[model samples]
Target: MKDLTYRLPQRRELTTALPGPKSRELSARREAAVTAAVSPGLPGWVVDADGGVLLDADGNSFIDFASGIAVTSVGASNAKVAEAVAEAASHFTHTSFMVSPYESYVAVAEKLNEITPGDHAKKSVLLNSGAEAVENAVKIARSYTGKNAVLVFDNSYHGRTNLTMAMTAKNKPYKTGFGPLASEVYRAPMSYPLRDGLSGAEAAARSIRAIEQQVGAENLACLVIEPIQGEGGFIEPAAGFLPALSQWCTENNVVFVADEIQAGLCRTGSWFACDQEGVVPDLVTTAKGIAGGMPLSAVTGRSEIMDAPVVGGLGGTYGGNPVACAAAIAAISEMEEHDLAARALEIEAIIREVFEPLNGQDTVAEIRGRGAMVALELVDAEGHPNAALTAKVAAECKAQGILLLTCGMDGNVIRLLPPLVISEELLRDGLNVLVKSINANS
Candidate 1:
């Protein structure tokens, strides 16, 4: 494995207070220029980022508990990725894959085809974002199966596109006011081991029963799922649940599409989170961490299913842009040479190590996640979701120079998505802040 040579300082340092004068001025300007709909989770504006730290306009360097919403697995600006991007940009930025082909695009496709789950001859369609990849996956699935229904899970988070928004389980913020969503999108139960008392088999049976009764297996084109639901608070579908669902999809000819957008590309202890369970998805959509924050996504699957779409059925103007493809090539190379999957496991171990002491705390209902994508679900004394405490804890951590993010429909989950490249020292320091924050908030 290649040794890390992090350029940024390893420790959190604050030259100014939380949102300092410069960041506050920028925020004020941003309010006037940017859309109100675009929520800035952090009050400060970022000027630079490297390794596991984000340097804001305020000169406050924060330990990045959230890796740009899990997009920068190899670190926000890996030297290798930046160098590749610069070289690619110098040659040609974009001719559009449809207008003119490039080797970098083809190389990225080849890498994705080789790495993604499943051994069957796989074909990939590249896009600019997770939403686009998902949209294309649906198109491919429907084309292959000649079916209209697409099944997504409750508490699942897909994307913001029209079809993907309908696929998403949350109604507010993401789905609200987005009227007349795409049709034939069905919501099914997910396996949340903490919330539901059912075993993996039982959860699978429950979901299957719902799918069979509501959206019949014959009518379904595909079952799009996150092996680990990201916005649903990093919920890992119970063991055996995914395999059973995959088996069911196989038996019924349903295209089981695993949305590994936030969980893939070595962010979750494995190349893909589906690898943990050996769940070979017929169609797997990937993005986010795929290009080390270069805005590249792909839908790779069995060749037969992927080929169902006619010529020109799936091509995007900016999809697989040479620059992004170059970044992807570099990012994948870094992941391989650095053994990022193992790094993700090590990150998870560090997080769990810090969390073990707080295991019995009532406010800390559950501490879960695989690899660097971990979360703490906070609940009140009555065992109800405690959004208040969650907010407080995050605020306290941020004040102390740790950047943590909250998720879940109820907004009670504090998710930690430190870059897989985070050092043991920075990770432990972030965890220390997290622990202190949670204790004070509790």
Candidate 2:
């Protein structure tokens, strides 16, 4: 293994208020120039980031637990990723893969094909974002099965695009005012064990019944799901839920697509969350952690399904940018060399060690998730969503110089997506602050 070092000190430091004077000035400028729709989580005005620390313009250092929405699994300023990006940029940046092919793009596809589940013959198509990868996965499924209906789950968050918005379950911020979404998308019951109190098989049966009664199997093109949901409270389905769905998709000829955009690439103690249950899908959509902060995504699947799309029917001008591909290659190497998957397991153990006892608290409904992607579901004494307390806890953490993120349909789940390369001391400090904040808010 190669020796790696963090560029900045791993401690959280506060020299000014939450949104310091510099951040406040930037926020004012942003309000005037940028639209109100583009709201940032914390007005920190980051100037540099390394390891688990984010240095803002106001000279405050924050412990990063969000990982930039799970995009920088290898750390924000990973040396190998930076070196590769600079090297690739010096050579040539853009020569659209469609117009003039590049070796790095093909190399990335090959790497993805080899790492993704299943030993069968497979292929991959690179894209610019997770939404595009999912959209293309659906397109490939439709082309292969000649069906138009897509099946998603309740409480699922796919993307913000027209088709994905139609597939998503949340209606408030993502779907509101963006009506007239794409047609032929259906939602089914998900295996939420905490809320439903049903076994894995029982939940699968319920979903199967819904599919059969509402949208018949013959009419469905694909069944898309996030193995460990990111925005939907990091919900991990019951143990046997995924396997049963995979079998059903096989029997009905419907493409099984695992939306591993946020949960894949070592974020969940494995290359992909689907691997935890040995559930191999026909298609897998990947992004976020793929390139260590670079914009890149891909859909890897069985050769026949991926090949179903016509030659010119797929691809974009910046689908497989060379620099992004290089960054992906180096970031993948960093993960492999450093064994970040195992590191993720260590992070999980640290988090659970600190948070497991909170399960008995009246305001804590559940503590669930796998690997580095953990969530704390906040609820009132009557078991109702306590979004108010959740927001307060996050605000308090931010004031203390710890960057936290909240999610869930009701905005009552606090998600922790620390970079896989984060040190144990830094992660524990962040968690300690979070626990104190939760206790204070409660």
Candidate 3:
């Protein structure tokens, strides 16, 4: 394996059409063997990657803007991440964290404790995915608080697992037929300033009132929230909402959990999005971007709450795999050394400078977000959401070689989660492409 500080390569390259012949062949074989419902929307195959460029199997190279749904914070094919993964793979790979403890696993947990918010003594338990961490968090909260119900926000996206699906508020794509989900999950209103006419305090009050009335504070085990709702449209709760909710949780003995899976690891210009509001949650769940693309998730929280679950209740056979833990350690170190949080702020600045002017335009409704975790919602002159326009803009950006993703409950928001390590020049170029796409669509 190479040294951890090695750098990445330059921009994209393309010699053949996207999903070149080789990729097409492989994709066809996959379609034949696997369910077509799980296929990805964009180019489906990647042969190799270096720096920000992904070389597809068909001899096409493309700049990766999605970052694997905000997982690869350092950039795809980061040299340090690659070296770390290679080194870990060369060592003993699997020893279930429960069966035999390993240094990397514990080291990763320690890193999470130090990096996550609050000076309180924190303990971490590793998991394989964000949903697992969230699920375990509920289990711990219930065990500790002796409560039956959990409170989740509307339009929130936790994960695809059954319990998480029940916790998730979306319907068509994620929860369509997953009937009779886990019981005792209650829904609450999320404070979306863009659509909901309320300030942070007002929104928080309204949501808390609903929770208190519907579930009764004593019956609530935990209140789980996404500091910046990922699939719910990159929505940042009203400024005071989080702090207010945290205080309420404290007084009511409800575990305040922040699901920072998509908003952590400096993607939101902060170590965790909860930091934006100066809110310290009892439990913080993180996964995306933690291992620079490796599958690793964790639930870090107050030591006592974490200890609520009895011994044997909190692990998986593959939880805390050594390689993923090693990758997490290296990825987090890289984030710190490179000051990715500051870079996320820089990215946000660039985005605001480019999109702020569009705010008052008939085709643009609102430009909102914190740090690089930014989004813009499209609306018509009458203030109706223009999902069609957003879709057109995204397609145009893709055709012009700039990748983008659309999100939000109405599908009218454009979210940007570029790698924090992307060069300023390339970043600006991509933004320019986005502006052009929006203008053309308008």
Candidate with top lDDT is 2
Better of 1 and 2 by lDDT: 2
Better of 2 and 3 by TM-score: 2
lDDT of 3 at 404: 76
Tens-place lDDT per residue, model 3, 168-248, is 998878888878798899999999887897998999999999998999998999999998998888888777989999999
Off by over 4 Å in 1: 1-3
Ranking by TM-score: 2, 1, 3
Per-residue lDDT of 1-442 in model 1, one digit per residue for the tens? 2237888787798898768999989888988999999978776789899998998987788899888889998899899999999999999999999998999988988999999987889889889999999989999999999999999998998899999999898888899998899999999899999999788899999999999999999999999999999998889878899999999999999999999999999888899999998999999999999898898999999999999999999998999999999999999999999899998888888789888878999898899889888999999999999999999988888888889999998999999998888888888998988898888767
Q: What is the C-alpha lDDT of each candidate?
A: 0.91, 0.94, 0.85
lDDT of 2 by residue, 220-286 (tens): 9999999988898899999999999999999999999999999999999999999999999999999
For model 1, state the Cα shift of residue 210 in Å: 0.8
Residue 6 in candidate 3 has what lDDT? 19
In candidate 1, how many Å is residue 23 off? 0.9
Candidate order by decreasing lDDT: 2, 1, 3
State the displacement of the C-alpha of residue 168, model 1, in Å, after optimal TM-score superposition. 0.6
Candidate 1 has its poorest 10 consecutive residues by lDDT at: 1-10
